[model samples]
Target chain A: MSTWSMALRQSDYYWTLYRRTWKGSVFSSFLTPLLYVLAMGVLLGGFVEADPSRLEGAPSYLAFVAPGLLAAQTMQTAVFETTYPVLSATKWQRVYFGMNATPLRALDIANAALGFVLLRLVLIAIVFVAVLAPFGVFVSVPAAIGALLVSILVGAAIGMPVYAYAVGVPNESSFSLIFRLGVIPQFLFSGAFFPISNLSPALEWLARLTPLYQGVDLTRMLSLGTWHTGPALVHLAYLLVLLVVFHRVAVRRLAKRLAF
Target chain B: MISARGLRKSFQQKGQEPFEAVRGIDVEVRRGEAFGFLGPNGAGKSSTMRMIAAVSPVSGGSLRILGLDPATDGSQIRGRIGVCPQEDSLDTELTVAENLYVYGRYFGIGRAEVRRRAAAQLEFVQLTERGGAKVEDLSGGMKRRLTIARSMINDPEMVLLDEPTTGLDPQARHVLWDRLFRLKQQGVTLVITTHYMDEAEQLCDRLVVMDKGLIVAEGSPASLIAEYSTREVAEVRFGIGENESSAGAVESAVGRRAERVEVLPDRLLIYAADGEAAVAAVHDAGLQPVATLVRRSSLEDVFLRLTGRTLVD
Candidate 1:
């Protein structure tokens, strides 16, 4: 069989597995951002002033936080979705054993899993953007589209490494560590909800090193049309480097784990 | 055909010893033949099977399946081999039909063809009605049948079944055996590992008995029986108390009439060419046993004689 067909088949397999097992989680992913928009944007925005300094020249707190939330939520969903499930397919559930026993190769399974995660990110981003647009958070149609694409790239950039980590280990504790030390730190330091200028220089440097920060910055640039070429290029470069590096690591780890 | 020369595998445990799971062993399985490995647990049957399935790398050996080396051409070799693992590895998230459909796709089968085979295989396993129901809802036997059917979705050239009927009920086992027999008739090479003597006798044309990662004997069931045991076996169960000495009585009773005498915990087995004459000799010797049964010698006796222990032990 052709490589594309094999990859597509694996993609469909994961999609079906995800739909059956994680449909509720998908709905829950959309609900998290919706609640944030309601509780932080509308409820808190009612009392707080719409300061341009706080929002970095966006029209409202809702507008600024909306794009960042979209990007952050996509990263969150994609990272969690890919990590445990991919690990389970290898070690716990052993679904990969059955798949590898067939004509499908390790690269096919990895590509399928990443492709499925991207599809889910697209769906979740659409719902998130649609929900936020009516609240005066639609900066521009092109910017919104750019935000969606950036979300997928950023999520993949963060997630693919976690995927590599997941396939490399044989237990669930490694995933927990990734979430606690890897993902949680990214959430706190990546400037997803707050400005990086407020943090210490040490933390600022560390935040800039993460894919989540690059993603949040990219989304901010796209949504607000406030382009800073140096930082923009740096963020894009960080994400691109992560994609290539982690994708190669993931392929190698999967070949070792599944191909045996 | 599948061939392995000096196949060896070892696992390194953390802060402990490195255990050799499969010692250097050679094997050759011709096409359209049923090959079996009969051994107790921890005897490396599963490990050897895993290497042959191309899902486990050999630590040192030359291994080939369907004329392709598993190390260099694993994907090509695995593309045409179906494997049913010792453990049930079906996807519990999807329905029985979806399980087969997804597996077929893993073999790079087209969507239309996957759907068609999923339907037919489900029917073949008598699980058409449960196709839509989730795998977690199905009975153990039903799930096993689904696993068997799922392995055949690609119509593989060779199928490797590791203890396929390990935990099934008798009726379920019979049904599975029938299905496997039909697959054999269709010219598919089968490589199986089982400790069940009856299962090995019923399914395998030739087999190798393995113990501690080494082959103890290799031959047809009937030939092994003929070589290892007499034509008939007489079983005598004594009603004597636990502390009573029945061994002395049993030895004196059929000691001269039978070719060999085995003293088990619960019963005494007498190996003889004619079981009727052995029983008469035991009665004439004035040993009144509680129960006496005469049956044809089987592969179970051959295995016990060769390994000097029970298959389960």
Candidate 2:
């Protein structure tokens, strides 16, 4: 088989295992988006005043935060998928070693794992979009599709680096630190909850430097049908570049770590 | 099927001197033979096995598997051989059958073919009934059988088993051995590494005894015994620490019949062509012993004679 097909076949292992647990994941994949749309958008959004100018032409707070929540959720999913699971496969369960004993190389294992993560990101994006669609959160069909694609890109950008880190860490103790200092901070301060312009100027600049903020901004613009060509390209470029660089780095790290 | 010359492996941790695991050992395993590497822990057996399995890189020296250089064609080499590592690398989350199916898929086997082989292998390992059970739910022996079953999922030409029965009970080991013996009968080349001498005797056609990262002796089981040890051994125990002081008497008592007397803290092992005659000589010399027994010599004696230490220790 070609290397690409071999990698795809390797990913089927994860797919087989995932089939046993996807039912239990309904809480995060389906209900989390529904809860966020209802509790945060419908209920909490009523208390906040909608300012189309400041909200970048969004009709209401619900429309504004829906895509941002989707982007944040994607980041969270990507981080969750990459951290403990990658470590467990590399160390505890040694699934990668088992595959390496076969015709699959380290590159194939990395590609297989990353491909599985991307498959999950796409499924979660679909659920998030479908869940919020009836609430009229998106302005157009193209906007919904655009936000979905951008969310998956954002997930890849965040997840690939986390995978590299996961492969290098000696144990799970560092995972809590990553969640506390890295993932949690990005979730709270990366323009997912409010406009970065609303934060202090320094904090806003720092937030803009984060990949999630770029995703959130692009997703929100796409959802509200207010994105411009130049700024959208810039955000897409940042996310695309981050995704490619970290993906290559993750593949290299897996190869190095599995080289024992 | 496998060849190596001056094969070496070293590990270099940061800020520490490099530690050589396999120190320049030459080995050859022909096709259709059950070969073994017999050694204690840290004897470089696993390291050598990894190189042959095409997983670990050779630190230095030349090695080849199925005539392919691992440095350039590792995946190709791996495609033709199966490896059961010392540690259990089986996926705990997967079911028994699922593990086989997934591992077969890694070899790029078609889904239908994987399913067919998975069932056949499960039956081969006598785990057909446990196919749907989670891997963690099985006992250690069952898990090991499942691992062996998964190793055969790709229908590999050769199988490398590192300590295949290390933690198994005697019955479990026997069951596993029966399965492995069946594989050998089917013409699959088997290369095993083990600390247990009986396992080597039971399964291997020929073996190399390793110690301190070096091959100390190499031959068939009986040949090595003939070369390094006598036909039999007489064990005489004078009770506890008394055996140490009684070594001189025991050695002098048996005389020429006792080719050598290995004194331990609790007993004296008198090597002889006739173990009962050696024990009778000890009695005739009026050296009173608490207990006595005679048995044929084995690979253990050969290793002890070569390394001057026990294999398991």
Candidate 3:
């Protein structure tokens, strides 16, 4: 079989196992987005709508923050899917070694991992948008699709590097540090919650240059339908470059870790 | 079939010195035969098995699997070979049937074919009733049999088993041995690495005794015994810690009357073509052994003769 198909077959293993636990993941996949929209969109958007000073460019905070949350949640879902599960397969459960014993190469396993996580990212993004749409955050259908693209792109960018780190960890405890230090800060400060323009100039620039911020800008512009083609291309370029570069790093790291 | 010439495996160390796990050695595994690597732990048995399975690289020597070079044709070689690793690495989250189905997919098998093989294999391993049970719920022997069944999914030409029965009970080991013997009967080339002498004698058509990363002796089990040992052995124990003191008397009594005599801490092993004659000679010399027993020679005697009782690993 070709490497691509072999890799997908590897993912079929994960997908089949996921079927066993997919019911348990209802809270994260469905409830988390529902509550996020209710608390951040309806409740907090009421206060922000009364005060437009905080939300400058948009009509309401719900419209402004929904797509941005879409981007960040995609990142969260992608990283979560790849971390402990990757560790379980590679180290704890040792299924990767079993895969390596077959015709599947390490590269096939790595690529299949990304494919599986992307599939999950798409599903989570769909759930996020489905909930956000009922909350009246998505303005147009094309804009929602644009936001979905940016979300999966941002997720792929961040997910690849985290997967590399996940496969190398001696245990699972250190993963808490990734969410606390890497993901939580990006969630709060990456223009998803509020405009980066209000932040200190240096911090704002740093945030704007990172991957999630680029995703936030792209998704927010797409959701609001106010994006200029030039800036949209730039943001898309930023996320695309990060995705390509980090995917190479991820494949190499996983291959090195799994090598005999 | 598998062939190796001067196969070596070494692990590189960061700042410290590198360690060679398998020193250069030659080996040939023929089709339709059960070949074994017999040694204690750390004898580089697993390392050699991994290399032959094509999952591990050979550090210094030329090696081939199914007539293909592993360096250039690793994936192709692996496609035709099955490996049952020493560790039970089955997916616990997957049921017994699911584990086999998912593993077969890695070889790019069709879904229907995988299901078919999974069922047939489960029945072959006598785990048909437990197909839907989770791997964690299975016993150690059951897990091992499942592993063996999984290895047969690809219909591999050669099966490499790394201590396949390492942690099994006597009954469990015999069951696995019986299944492996069936595979050998089906004309599948079998390469097994084990530390159990009886297991080696039972399963292997031709075998090599390894010690400290080297092949010390190679032959069929009985041939190894006849060459390195004798037809029978007279084991005489004087008492706890007394064999050392009585070594000289036992040696002189059994001298020339036996092919060789080894004084172990607990007993004296007198190797002779005839154990009864050797016992009479021991009594004729005015030496008294607290306990004496005679038994036919086996692979353990060959190992002791070549590697001595001192553990190399």
Who wins the DockQ comparison? 2
- Rank by TM-score, descending? 2, 3, 1
Q: Which stretches of candidate 2 lie over 4 Å from their true place?
A: none
Query: What is the Å distance of residue B62 in model 3 from its true position?
Result: 0.7
CA lDDT, every prediction? 0.83, 0.90, 0.86
Cα RMSD to native, each candidate?
2.7, 1.7, 2.2
Of the two candidates 2 and 3, the one with more favorable lDDT, higher being better, is 2
Colliding residue pairs in candidate 2? none
lDDT of 1 by residue, A1-260 (tens): 56677788776677786776566766776677789899877787666575677666677767767777887888887888778878778866688777878767788778887788777777777788777777767677887788878877887787778788888787877777888887788876688767786689998888877778889988888888887899888888889899899889989889887643
Candidate 2 C-alpha lDDT tens digits along B1-313:
9999999999998999999999999999999999999998999999999889888889999998999999999989898998888888899898998899989988888999999999999989999999999998999999889888888888899999999999899999999999999999999999999999999999999999998889999999989999999999998999778988999988888889879999766688999999999999989999889999999998989988888888888
DockQ for candidate 2, C-alpha atoms: 0.80
Candidate 3 accuracy as TM-score:
0.94
What's the lDDT for candidate 3? 0.86
State the weakest 10-residue window (summed lDDT) of model 1 chain A. Answer: A21-30
* lDDT of candidate 1 over B16-104, digit per residue (tens): 88889888888989999999999999999998998998878889878889999887788788878888888777888788888998888
Off by over 4 Å in 3: A49-56, B280-290, B310-313
